[model samples]
Target: MNTRPAGQDYIATLDLLRLAAALAVVLFHYFFRGAAAEGFLAECYPLAAPFALYGYLGVNLFFLISGFVIAWSAESRSWDQFAIARFVRLYPGFLFCMTITFAIVVLAGSPLLSASFSQYAANLSMFAPAFGQPFMDGVYWSIVLELVFYGWVTLALFTGLFQKRKLELIFVWLTISALNEFFLGSGAARLLFITEFGPFFAAGVLVHHIHAHGRSLPALLLLAAAFLISCGTLSVTRHWMQNHYGIAVSSANLVVANVVMHAALIGAVLLRHRVRPSALILALGGLTYPLYLLHQNIGYLAINAATPVVGKWFAAVGCVALMLFVSWAIWRSCERPAQRLLRIWLGRAVDIGLARFRRVSTEAQPAE
Candidate 1:
């Protein structure tokens, strides 16, 4: 059996890092109930506050990794091929999870669920809650953003914008981000999908380019600066209309910071080879999607069930543990198997298309 230990190289190392990030998110929720201002849930946990605070960063880490990994996947393929691959990779898991979540909500008789069949249909299609209303799955928002990024990448590829000049692309996005930071408030600065994140995504693309170009002193310095800025460790303050603009820069700044840190972390993992303890990390990655989807609802249920029996801390812990266990089981069973099935189905469709094309070509030819 060619079970092939999955992550054996730099790419694998990034996968391991992704798993670690997922675990950080899990631990963050487990301890702090997803609230940053709150301290540890219990006296036994000292690291909870820092960990929970960084949980939001974990999602950005996934986005940064997604951009880098998608660039890596799309490198050798044409736009159409890349789009199909991305669709197959993302949609199947997403749809399945959404359905399961909606069903669970319905079964649980949550008042938040749609009252009618059409409303349920809308939720299932992922287009519901279009006007600031949260969707059936709280985690679906990020999925939507990811889909937008995928569409943007596809458009860039078709327009020849992604053909060459990787760093130039990154710089262009950075400029947009900076300029947007300067002009528009943080709210409007977020319109950078067309204007900004391209660079961050391009930075991921630049990761491939940097390897080809070879690292230089200047490049290293720039990367270091970008890293510092993204991590919010760089102490630079500029005025933004009475606000000190310390933590509250442009939305573009926060986005850029996230992408930069993400790229740096992925790059570092790829560059280094040493493996640390990863059981929890691996488990977290496997369960992240489900946990993210189910955590809030499950946590609520858990609190309701346990608040009467024990204190909030004990109840929260038990709930989180139960959620984790259920998510892990789903990942092992439904999620992994469903993904495999979808891949197979998509592969067969591609094969059929190719076979039909060949047949049409053969019939059209004259006697040869």
Candidate 2:
């Protein structure tokens, strides 16, 4: 059912789902990955590690949601508008959170976590690794992937391909993704086309197509293809976990988790009518971006600092609560205002540029 709430273009349920995915990632980092033999944590939570190990899948969930959301967002705007909207949405929050993380790491950084002026400067571009600098926070790697995805979407919109030949485009994209991931194993292709994670993103786009335009045979088939490809790509994550922690996540569990995540996306779209949109729901969704951006390294520092006095469980829980509050504050106090200002400035600049280009074209044309 494509019944969105009146006067709203977005599905409110998706916001809640985003927050849930963010929390899962936070827990995964805190309870499982942080405690590995060479992990960041000073203490381990053996009990929670088993369940939290699966939490890394939350990033996969975020990609799926982003595909649906980006497609929905691009549908109603011109290419420049889409670009501005995405920039204003992502950059302000990223800057604020990145700066906060930088300051924290500089002032109170442990050997495990620290920052330099060059690194911070590189991070300002939002693609730090290209400049031979590491991300100030490890979580920024995902943000870079997101930026690459947005770059592709912006290009598609510019060429009118996204609007006119979206399904065909997705087919080619999925095909390339399968080839590189399953056979070629080219790291460049993996980075450029996002081969490893493209299926999750493509699945999201197909889901949006079904939600908005109604499910057709072709769309359904492509979506099924996406699901199968996604299951295969889970091997990438399994391999990483094995190499890093020497733990193997079974293929069966990975497939089951992937299935459940895809199912959840479908269910959210179908039952969207049941979620009533409210300011609180919007805020929860808003906070998730900053929460995801700020949670990892800063959280490690916080947990390590607090664990001795308050104990490990309280330290972990308290750090989460603190991060949530900080993220909410950033969303409300920083991101909203900065976005409003950037939207105004960027909108006017784009309008002026487009007007000049039109004038030049008009003057260059012969009188009819």
Candidate 3:
């Protein structure tokens, strides 16, 4: 979505894309392979199951969206402001979801696929395992990837590299990702830099450059390279599908997902002219982060309990509805308030700290 001129922040159509990608993920986990986790769905819902297999592509969709938007967010702001904005945007929803999930899982007595107090403490930082605490849900792995992406973006912003050398940086990033994924193929590389998945993020960044500036032959070439590299590095997902589910993930589906994402993103930019912004759409987008964060483990537990009482189809659909409602409530009650408060507090703190630094600098200047 194109960032409108100042005073026009929200883009309605992109919000719809957010909801769609999140719903695809939920369906994949709940209806398709969801049975594996929830235990009540069984070898059931066969009609819908086959089609849902590819829903994991939603995560890639999400990465693309983040790349576009995060770049937009960073384009004009100081790194301090950018960091604060990202924190308030991400952390509030994350905190609410993590705490809520921990409570639900614990109270339900199905806790700990390996849960413990130390892990719970670690989860507060959102990097979980770094401090030796497990993530409240497995879905958190992507969140960490997002944080790493942000780290790089933040570094770029700090060095003034992002503004002047944006395309060059993307080219370098894509090259590094390709070399890491295809050539080095090191486990540590995948873990820390997550180079295997960097192309998707780079593709989104390249798309943003195209969206903001018009398409150039050079930019188009880079976009093409990023997309192809992403396709090549999909070995991780394919291997995951085969190992975990004992089924091959079709290469055609991988190609289709990539194509669809390119179209969706490009289409958003194209339609930016036609699509008027709406608050409803903005709110819908707001619900997505919370919904994505809260959906997986808790939904599984809900499904397990509700299935016998409600019947499978109704239970699944009903739980989806229930979570939507829950997400809305979280948005209204938890996320908005927390973000507002954190911003106020952080703003004052940054001000105080900066003031102190200025004072100390004046003192140290000595007869200047």
Task: Estimate the Cα RMSD of every predicted model relative to the unseen true structure.
Answer: 6.5, 2.4, 2.3
Model 1 Cα displacement at 276 (Å)? 9.0
**Clash count for each candidate, listed in order shown:** 1, 0, 2
lDDT, candidate 2, equals 0.90
Tens-digit per-residue lDDT, 97-191, candidate 3: 98888888778835423356777789999988888767898889998898888888889899999988988998888887888888898887786
Ranking by TM-score: 2, 3, 1
Residue pairs with clashing backbones, model 1: 230-257
In terms of lDDT, the poorest run of 10 residues in model 1 is: 1-10
Cα deviation of 240, candidate 3, in Å: 1.6
lDDT of 2 by residue, 1-368 (tens): 01122234667889988998999999999999887865688989988899998889999999999888888888878889888888888899999999999999999885888799999999999999999999988888888888889899999999999999999999999999999989999999999999999999999999999988998999999999999999999999899889878996799999999999999999989989899889998889989999999999999889999999999999999999999999999999999999889989999999999999999999999999
- Candidate 1 regions with alpha-carbon error over 4 angstroms: 1-10, 27-51, 109-119, 131-133, 185-203, 211-213, 216-272, 276-284, 348-368
Ranking by lDDT: 2, 3, 1
Cα error, candidate 2, residue 153 (Å): 1.3
Ranking 1 against 2 by TM-score, winner: 2
Flag the better candidate by TM-score, 1 or 3.
Answer: 3
lDDT at 184, model 1: 54
Best by TM-score: 2
Q: Which stretches of candidate 2 lie over 4 Å from their true place?
A: 1-7, 366-368
Against the unseen true structure, what C-alpha lDDT does each candidate score?
0.56, 0.90, 0.81
